[model samples]
Target: MGAAAYALWGSFPLYFSALAPAGSVEVLVHRVLWSLLLCAVLLAALRGLGDLRALLADRTRTGWLGLAAVTIAANWGVYIYGVQSGNVIEASLGYFVNPLVTVLLGVLLLRERLRPAQWAAVGVGVVAVGVITVDYGRVPWIALVLALTFGSYGLAKNRVGRGTPALVSLTGETLLLAPFALAALVVLEVAGEGTFTSAGPVHTALLVSTGVATTVPLLLFGAAARRVPLTTIGLLQYLTPVLQLLCGVLLLGEEMPPTRWVGFALVWLALVVLTTDTLRAARRRAALARSAVASAHG
Candidate 1:
């Protein structure tokens, strides 16, 4: 399930690319509106409407979800633009950098202390960004925006606290954005720029599929989370970006100049360091638990 989720996420470049002549904003608006409709239907079928209502009643949680909606919307918009503009490799870099960005957010916002290995990993990530920036001859703003917005979205979701069903939370977020999305669609249509009516039925179907494309992976990941260890999920997270990178370079035929290669190599090195530390930490905790159990038995 985890692999399937990541694979679907990684293949998004191909999906978004196929939406050409629609432009990023139009695609994003359709994604938001259709995803909301789908979420509403799923919630009703699952009898989760009560959960959604309860979530909306909480002012604090609703505010956090609102922020989450904004950040994730930005992430989706920037990602669509990147894929549509043939910057798939750079967009892939964003996800590759996201875990590190999350860690950085923890240190800065939560005042969490990082272990030595984590510090080293973050340092390497910074240098990797610098190298990539130089290679691009400008700040890789698309990558940075994607990473920061996604990191912010995660933080906002964390503030909303757990125990909220993923579907419920998503419904709330999309509900918050639905009005704006609807208005945008209307404006686009008034300007004769909307593709929904003008685009052929195949294009319309593909556009509508954006909702399923967005929701299915989340459902898969949610299911996988209940059955897998956090460490396993952490490891699985890399699969999405790795597949995306492959799609960009192999399928899209994007050039990876030597300097860009070196930058990505550094990012990979940092991920290796971070993953090793995570595995070691998980093992230590397991060993401690085993020792405690043994003592209790004795």
Candidate 2:
């Protein structure tokens, strides 16, 4: 399930590519509409309406989701634009950097502590960014924007409490955004610029399919995270960026300079360090738990 989730996300360039003639904004609006409908059905089937209602009723919690919706939508828009503009490599860089961004947000916003190794990993990530910047002669703003927005989304979800059901929260998020989304769609239709109207049957279907493409992986990733350990899920999360990087390089034939490769290598090295730290932490906890039980028996 985790692999499936990452794979779907990694191959998003293909899906988004098929949604041609519609600007990223139009496609994103359609995604919100369709994903809401699908999530609404799933919420109903799972009897999650009560959860949804409670989330909506709690002003504080609802505020977090509202905040998250902004970041998620921004992340989606930037990502779609990146893919459409032949910047998939830069887009992949965003996901590759996202885990580090999340950790940084934890430290900065949540007042959390990090291990020395984790700190080293972050330092390396910064160096990687420097290397890439020097190579490109400009800051990779698209990747940075994507990472920051998604990281903010993660922080907002964390603030909302982990107990919130994924489908329920997402459905409610769509509900919150639905008014603006519907308004945009209506405006586009009136102007005859909407993809659903101008893009023809196949493209229209592809645009609609973005909803399922967006939601299913999220549902699967949530389920997998629940059933799996953080260490395992952390490792699995790398698959998305790895696959995306491949798509950008191999499938799209994007030019990758030697310096760009070096930067990516440094980033990958940082991830390896972080993943090792997570595994070590998890194993240490497990061993301590076992020793406690043994001591009790002894």
lDDT of 1: 0.95
User: Candidate 1 lDDT, tens digit per residue, 1-298?
Assistant: 9999999999999999999889999999999999999999999999999999998999999999999999999999999999999999999999999999999999999999999999999999999999999999999999999999999999999988778888999989999999999999999999999998797999999999999999999999999999999999999999999999999999999999999999999999999999999899999999999999999999
How far off is residue 286 in model 2, in Å?
1.8
Clashing pairs in 1: none
Stretches of candidate 1 exceeding 4 Å from the true structure: none
Candidates' TM-scores? 0.98, 0.96
Top of the candidates by TM-score? 1
RMSD (Cα, Å) of candidate 1?
0.9
Report lDDT per candidate: 0.95, 0.91
